[model samples]
Target: MPLLRTNTADKFIVDRRKTHRNSDVSRAVKHTRDRLSQRSGSPAFDRELLKLHARAIVTGASAIPLLVLVIAAAGLLGGMGGTILSWALVTVTCYTGIALFARSIDKADTARIELAATKRNFLILHSLSGLCWAYLASLGCGECQVEQFPVIKAVVLLLAMAATAIIASSLRGALVATFAAPVIVYGVVGARYWMPVEATMIGLLAISLPFFAYVAGHLNRSALMLLSFRREKDGLIAELETAKSMSDEARRRAEEANLAKSRFLASMSHELRTPLNAILGFSEVMSNEVLGQIQNTTYKEYARDIHDSGRHLLDLINEILDLSRIEAGRYQLNEEPVSLLDVVEECCHLMELRARNKDLRIVQQFEASLPRLFADERAIRQIALNLISNAVKFTPAGGEIVVKVGWTAGGGQYVSVADDGPGIPPDEIPVVLSAFGQGSIAIKSAEQGTGLGLPIVQGLLAMHGGEFQLNSKLREGTEAIAIFPRGRVMEDMPALPTLPLRAVASGGRRR
Candidate 1:
């Protein structure tokens, strides 16, 4: 049980550590939202369904103007036949982008959302394509005879494409690729295609390089900070919830213990008062002869019975007080030389009278050669009395109760009380020794009991340098054993003779 408890505790600590280390709720929710929102076209889709398809058709149609120019450039470069191949490559690339955009409308596409990064990448590629457009348009090419469109339109398109790329992505490699645009614009607006505007445009794009880097670095740090705060807040919320649950469980356990304690206090008070009330009032009455007592023979017997009941209640209270002291670590033992046989004989004799009332017999067996055990005399006597009394209390009419004493060859004495009665059940064997516990068979057959008899015996045994053990079987019998160590085994062993029968309190009798 201890090992299992330790393993469970270790696992809980490991799990709790993970709970603090990991981001739990909000991060997971945010990630899921990112997955859902990243899909659907344009990175800005108001009505994802209608605009998704319309955007695809529009982007595909728009690619044809650039594709036609690229093919015209290829015809000039590869000498006529390569136009068809260039158009086919442009068609394929356009259709692929269209397919990705179209896929985002049907359902959330995690793969297609990643393809949005491809779209970002295409911006740099488009910037390079714009540089080509500017170069080809600058020449009086076969397809377009308009030379004015190259200087004005081509340079404008190249700068716009480069600026579009800077807005789309922060990746240094891709953004730097847009530098091709300024070079192409410089050539188109220069003297052959002749304009002074291209030099000023190159100077502006050169200044924008450091500006782009500064902006990208700032946004990256900001995004990293946001993610870190999200993880911290999520962990804190999980910890707070765990602490709340622990507090609730502790409060619930305390409430249950309090209820049980209240019931116990009430029961003990009622039980103790019943005998004490008679002892206080009647002892006073009999002493004063208020009822003209001491005349009839029955009067003496009644007084004796009341006195005995009160003393019995006092003994019970003392046992309870002793248990409280032990729990508080305040109980101390006074050691003396005690005979196991003498205490056993006395408990048997006291129980004999009680047992006879139920038509039960009490028996005692002692070894003549039994060695004396060093123990606390008062505590040992109480242990014997508690065990024998419980046996007599639970046994049926005509049942036999026996007390036995013997010595171990290894220098210990054993005292045992056995009864022929309905014994404890298997399930409740350990519980039979606990405070305020009784076995299933004991409760089933007996009417009234406080369930503290064996517990008192156990406490008294512990006070000595001894131990008490209980062994029982259902419907068979029970054997309660107390084993004491003699001589060298005793701690705090004071030199004193065994406590005689006369020295016991008036509650317990000795023959």
Candidate 2:
């Protein structure tokens, strides 16, 4: 019974886990979709985007200083030495300030971040960086004749614009804020030169600025998508943790209830039996007139009725206790070698008078030469008694019951009791097998029962490593079979060959 309870609890946990997992996934998906709908231009999204931008800035801070050094070296080779070197110093200082600001923002708590004020400050700093780049772009190499300087300046501006687009992509307008001034300054200065190379550089800057901005916008959307996926994952993990906690709570409650039931039954066994025994004993004495003859016939009849009721109540109590013990895995078996045929025959004989009173016939069929089964004798007797009594109780007057004990095809033994009673519906079979559960037919029958008989029989059979099956149709009778496995069938062993006593004595003398 404990095993059955554990299995039932495990099944429920598995089913509930699947159900909750599906619900959690659906809820997470719906929540993500709703957030996505309101994502663009929302204050909450802006704060998150700012945080991403800060993290990106801090991560690439080292690379920015290296790129500035390389650009400074290239400008010196082109003979734009002093002006280019001064711009590099200012650029590095500006980058250092931006990196420190971003680091502070990244280290601050998320809830404390003011999106509007922080975004305004970030754009102002980026514009300063853009003015530095503009200064570098407008620098001219007048001392040396370097025709490739225009190409070098254009390439440097383009690389810087692309880098800004990538690093500040999470913030919506950071790319435009950084490069818009540089593009304008470069185009204005190049138009002054009026040469083919400068004109081409101006046109390229004009086109590439908007292109990089568009690329940055796309990257920002990708970051939002990535954030949504991460939120959903965190939500799922939280849901699973909640489900596990609920499952543990449910199992704990079930265990507590089971323990309370066992304790109640344990206490009830003595509390109910003591009074019932007194009732039965006194009622029997009054009904039989053991002490003195009862003068009133009505009083005697009343005493007899009391005795019968008490006996029935006692039987019900016993059956309940037996079932409780079996379910709690406390029913101990006193195993012995016993004959299945003899057990069934004794049960039929005990139930014979009850069947006779109802004018029912119980036909017993036994297979001869059956082996003794190694099982609990009392449990086997109870199994046989329960089956036979159920048949006699339910079988209609003049209806015939067939009791058969025979070998199974697997060399095991089985006791089958079939009755021509009002049959149970197929759907109610499981209900009938449960403790304290009765089918409609059993409820409507003239003799009502506590409904623990078949359950007790099944429990006993399970203890013996056996099986119980009930077959019935609506109009046809019900057949109950209790099968003992082949392992429980004690087969006879062959005798060993004997040697002569004189030869043993002669061998002992020689030794």
Candidate 3:
């Protein structure tokens, strides 16, 4: 067991040394790969890199004066005049370089060549600055009085190394060079003039060198990752903007096409109605044999078929025109005080014959106290007519449909049409409400329609600040409701009294 322990200890020591050695070279290799492989080719990236270095230079320039004061106070300057001159030269050069580089990056466009040159110049400046700090830390201690505190000198040197590690961390190459140059220079000097206590401290400093490099490498990697993420976000935003522009263009074209179609339909209304009226008139006469008796009974039957088909076609055309007018925003309403009962009763009466034809029953429930509505009379008629028509059409043979007109709990009036038919699926409610969209059951039923009824109802109600709702479940039934807002409800007014005839005559004579 002891032999196994010794072998394990030896392996651990070797692995640790290997890690340290790899860390020393890892900074340079990783930095080279990061720059060469992930070259963003963005001018903004280059500009940002320049700005980071400029900030570091400016920060280092600020610390120079404070560092000089501390060293002078500690009596660690080997030659005070020489040390002060060197600090002034380095500080002035660093500040000047910072200003010039920052302005250059701002004013000049950054190309590939310019970016490479900037990186090279920055690395050189950072290396020279590191050498100056090394000189101050190593040779500056030559004239330190033996009585002066050694801890102060050590503190100043370590602090300078730590600050460099932090300040130059944005660029991996610059960070490694800045820290390594000073440490390597100092290590050589310390080896040349070694003492018992100082040698131990120097050895410790050497051991910590690789750790600082590793930290700077991690910082650089994090910065690159952040930049990459930002670039991707910007690209995504650009793509969304392009998509929005294309969508807007497509929508505009669709509107133009719809407008053209509406205009064509409106123009053709006169042409269509004139021939249709003539055909309906002539066909009805022939079927009834009003002018003369028909020799062949088949002629009368054919005339009846022609008349029915023409009437149905005319109804479909009228519906298409009405929907077009509503869609084009040209359907104007003449508002008036209208009785809801009158409109609903008239529609139910007109649809009664059609309901009887299909052997379906329509039940009418009207609230006697339901208030009048201030709305377009013709529009109300159309709304009721369309709802009753749909109910009668969808309700199965021998099925019942209910048409209800009453005041809602919210003090508004509503018209509801419910039928026992193959109801719409919940998901198809929206589809049925859309223009020219019908439910699957309605499509498969023998009586197919143009499918514009519900949408027309919805649009008209919307114009009156009202709402439309469709509630249904498959294989059960469907109820469509059209509600008017409270504002549209017309309150009842008291009737004015009339005076007696004799009193009115006496009053006129007195006047």
TM-scores vs. true structure, each candidate: 0.43, 0.79, 0.73
Candidate 3: C-alpha lDDT: 0.73
Which whole-number lDDT from 0 to 100 does residue 411 have in model 3? Answer: 81
lDDT of model 3 at position 287: 97
The 10-residue segment with the lowest total lDDT in model 1: 1-10
- Write one digit per residue (lDDT tens) for candidate 2, span 1-511: 0001111111011334354447766876687567556565777767778889999999998776778899989778867768878999999999999999999999998789998899999999999999998888778888768887877888988988888899999987888888888788888888887899999888988999999999999999999877767766766677678878988999999999999998898899899999999999999999999999999999999999999999899999899889888988999999999988888899899999999999999998888779899999999999999998898888889999999998887788889899989988976777778777778987887487888898899899999999888888877888888888999999799998777999889999999
lDDT of 1 at 255: 81
Question: How displaced is residue 96 in candidate 1, in Å?
Answer: 38
* TM-score top scorer: 2
Residue-level lDDT tens digits of model 3 in 119-145:
787787767766666665465344544
RMSD of each: 17.8, 5.4, 16.1
How do all the candidates rank in terms of TM-score, highest first? 2, 3, 1
Ranking by lDDT: 2, 3, 1
Compose the digit string of candidate 1's lDDT tens values, residues 1-511.
Answer: 0000101111011334444534665575566455444422334332332333234334444454454555556555544445444544554464455445444433555334444454454454545544444453344434534444434444444444444343433233334454455444455445463345545545444565556646645543444344445545655576578768988999899889866765675588678778687786787577557778587768766776677667666666766666655544566777666666787787787777778889998877888855456667777787788888888877888899888887654466777788988987755655666666777767777645666677666666656655666777667787887766565244444778867666765437543
Inter-residue clash pairs, candidate 2: none
